[model samples]
Target chain A: MSNTPNRNRQLRSKLGRVRGLGSSHEGVHHWWAQRMSAMALLPLSLWFIFSLISLTGSDYVAFQSWVSEFGNSVFLVLFLVSMFHHAQLGLQVVIEDYVHSELWKMGLLLIVKYGSVLFAASGIFAVLKISLAG
Target chain B: MAEDDRPLSPHLQVYRPQITSVLSITHRATGVFLSLAAVMLTYWLASAAYGPDSFARAQAALESWFGRLILFGFTFSLFFHMCNGIRHLGWDLGWGFDLVKLRMTGVLVIISAFGLTVLSWVMAYSHVGKL
Candidate 1:
């Protein structure tokens, strides 16, 4: 058993050897998630901008009616979810890079992670409330 | 701590600002700004859900001069981040790595971001018949 493990380690590439030893064991996941969310946000963000333009000078009722529509509500929720996910991941990288002290880094990371979830939940709830109630 | 004083690889302080480097950092800075902006977005949605009175207050606050200024900044930052993000995606696909192409794309990203921001604001103001 020991020899087999040693053989496997020897066969690993230089980069592979240290793959999961870093803080986040899931390698490339953060990078991949960021890119995927970015792609999703491209169309969703465009939709949001145009929608806001159309809603220009409109009152609360106009905005509410827009959100109450099924497609609009769905897209709004999707936009919020992806936006927060991307924001959290991007902010995590920024924090990790600049915040040298492990304590501060971890503290900010926790705040961002939790704050994103909380904000996302609130946004989604609001959308659902308008869509269903109105 | 003494070991930290040892010479390290070239970092931000050592390099004269170049287009590629400047844009790269700007991408990060805009991204952070947008993250903060998401709070306002949530506030808008939540206020709308709360009630008509709350929504009116929210709209009034956002439509103020200061609010418009912030919104304009948010708009530019968002478009800049989006345009540059596309450039980054292209690089990830192993395209546009040549020095000339890199500079070209960097410039293109800036122009496109500015253009889109201007276009969106124009559409917005035109829609409301006030600019």
Candidate 2:
């Protein structure tokens, strides 16, 4: 919804004045990306959970070798990136909705973006390091 | 519509509690939870990669009473979000837009989340002897 408190009537077109009442253009992209990641995560998350379950009673070597497999390692990175990116997008919206102050909103947005990226990078790095250790 | 007196949609307080509103809000809440849990997930992965000493510490934390409690919460949240997220993706494809189907799938997501939590813990318990 347009939170624009004041609109300049002089610049408003006929259609714009009558019907500009939905997401800003960027929202559609965010929505699309979130759904895209969600779809990807469906299968990836199932695999991750089941794979984790398989490793439950196993040891460090079992964990290492599981991730060391080529396909597993690649998907691990994909799953981490997609999950974090999707999370950042979702949290950004939550922050936007609740935090009305422009300064606080921007600050939270930066933290969510960078923090998710940092976590994703670390997860990916860990996966890669284990897989490559062999 | 005038900004001062715009006919906005009804606020949440106007509606009775229903699956639609409940699930919608729950979806957002679980998303926030999962995002925070990702940090813990990362710790598990990174510690595992760091080798035996680090992973042993990670394992100990995970098996501890407090850690298992957190893990239990995370596990349910993960499956719930996953199931509901798939339902959302279905909506994006223009499926399950009908009221009955939406309600059906929403109920299914909740049911499955519980079913999955029980199943996962059972599976974990079965591994106790194997450990």
**lDDT top scorer:** 1
True contacts kept of each: 0.83, 0.68
Fnat for model 1? 0.83
Runs of candidate 1 exceeding 4 Å displacement: A1-24, B1-11
Report the lDDT tens digits of candidate 2 across residue range B101-123. 99999999999999998898888
Write the residue-wise lDDT of candidate 1 on B1-131 in tens digits. Answer: 57446554347877999999999999999999999788889999999999999999999999999999888888999999999999999999999999999999999999998998999999999999997
CA lDDT of every candidate? 0.91, 0.85
- Residue B5 CA error for candidate 2 (Å)? 12
- DockQ, Cα level, model 2: 0.52
- Per-residue lDDT, model 1, residue B34, is 96
Evaluated at residue A7, the lDDT of candidate 1 is 45
Q: Taking the candidates in order, what DockQ does each have? A: 0.69, 0.52
**Would candidate 2 be rated incorrect, acceptable, medium or high by CAPRI criteria?**
medium
Docking class of 1: medium
Show model 2 residue runs off by greater than 4 Å. Answer: A1-23, B1-15
